[model samples]
Structures are given as C-alpha cells and as structure tokens.
Target: MRTIHAPRLLLLLGTSLLVRGGQTLRSGDHERGDVPGWVMITLMSATLVAVILFMAEEALTTMFKAAMDKVNNP
Candidate 1:
C-alpha cells in the first residue's frame, strides 16, 4: 500500500502545487518589487494544517474499523 499510496499522494501534491503556483504568481501585483513572503508562508502553513487534519481523521477511521472487527470476532 505504501508503494501505491506514496506515488498517488506525490502526484496529487505536485498537481496542486502547479495549479496554486500559477494562481499565486498571477495574483501578485506587477508593480510590487517584492511579493510578500508572509502571505506565502501563511498559505503553506494552512495547507499543511489541513493535510494533517485529514490524515488524522483517516487514521482514526482505520482504528475504529479495526476495533469493530476485533469485537465482532471475539
């Protein structure tokens, strides 16, 4: 599963990066000599937080299923 999952996750992240990168680059004002570094940091931070939450939820769900299976068999 790790072999299949890792590649899929990478592909998804790569696609997201390409799309978001274009949007972030285009949304900037051309007159601005430097884009705000803080904004990019914040966006990346938020994305990481969201991904963490999603993974946590998935872990909890797998644990729940395992617990239920053990109970049913015992």
Candidate 2:
C-alpha cells in the first residue's frame, strides 16, 4: 500500500486548492477586457476611412460615373 507522508499530503492539498482557486477566479465568460483600446482602434479606423473618402471623393465620383455610363450604354 502506498502511503502519503503528512508533508507530501499537505503539499498536494495546497497545490490543488491553489489550482481550484485560480479556476474559480477566472469566470469563463468571454472577457472583453480592453474596451478603451478597442474604442481607440475603432475611432482610428473610422478617421482613416473618412480621410480617404475625403481625399478620393473626386476620383471615386468619376469612376462611379464612368461605371454607370458603361452599364447604361450597354
């Protein structure tokens, strides 16, 4: 029969307790932790899109006009 020494048994129990405590602390919900970072990223992406649209407005308009003309003429 394998017998656990008192010190070994105490160490095993403590390790198991720590593992269980860690698991309990981590609630398994999908954690969205960095709200501000995501918000900043989203804002930056939107700003880039706005700037690109502003800069390319004339070109985009011309392209659309050409595409429509081709479609209508076809």
Candidate 3:
C-alpha cells in the first residue's frame, strides 16, 4: 500500500491554490490594470518548481540515504 505524505500533499495543495489565485487575479477587471502579467508568470513558475521538487523528494531522499550508508559502512 502506498502511503500519503502530509508535507507533499500540503505542497501540492498550496501549488493548486497559487495557480487558482493567479487565474483569479488574471481574470479580474483589466481597466484598473492592477494585475501585472509578470506576477502571474512568477506564481506559475513557483508552482511548477514546487511540483517538481515534490515529485523529486522521494528519489532525492533515497539517494541521500544510500550515500550516507555508504559513508558510514565504509
């Protein structure tokens, strides 16, 4: 059985919220020109990075553990 990691889940949820918030900001009244395009782009880039890091966490952890074990046992 696969276990769900809470921190990873929170990261995903936060990324989703960031994306949704960015969309809402983009869809707001344009006449006021309150939302800048760069802001949305930055939010989306951050979300992407968060997701990538979340996905890579397990692999990175495994690699680190293996390296540590090699050093300790050698």
| Residue 11 alpha-carbon offset, candidate 2, angstroms | 58
Q: Rank the candidates by TM-score, best first.
A: 2, 3, 1
Can you write out model 2's per-residue Cα lDDT over 1-74, one digit (the tens) per residue?
99765446555655665565456557654464554465456556655666777689899999999999999999
lDDT by residue for model 1 over 1-74, one digit each (tens)? 33435446656665676676667779875664444464466557756766775679789889999999999998
Q: What is the C-alpha lDDT of each candidate?
A: 0.66, 0.65, 0.71
Clash number for each model:
0, 0, 0
| Index of the highest-TM-score prediction | 2
- In order of appearance, the predictions have TM-scores of 0.34, 0.57, 0.42
Superposing every Cα of model 3 onto the true structure, what RMSD results?
6.6
Model 1 C-alpha RMSD vs. true structure (Å) is 6.9
Who wins the lDDT comparison?
3
Q: Which sections of candidate 1 miss by over 4 Å?
A: 1-4, 30-74
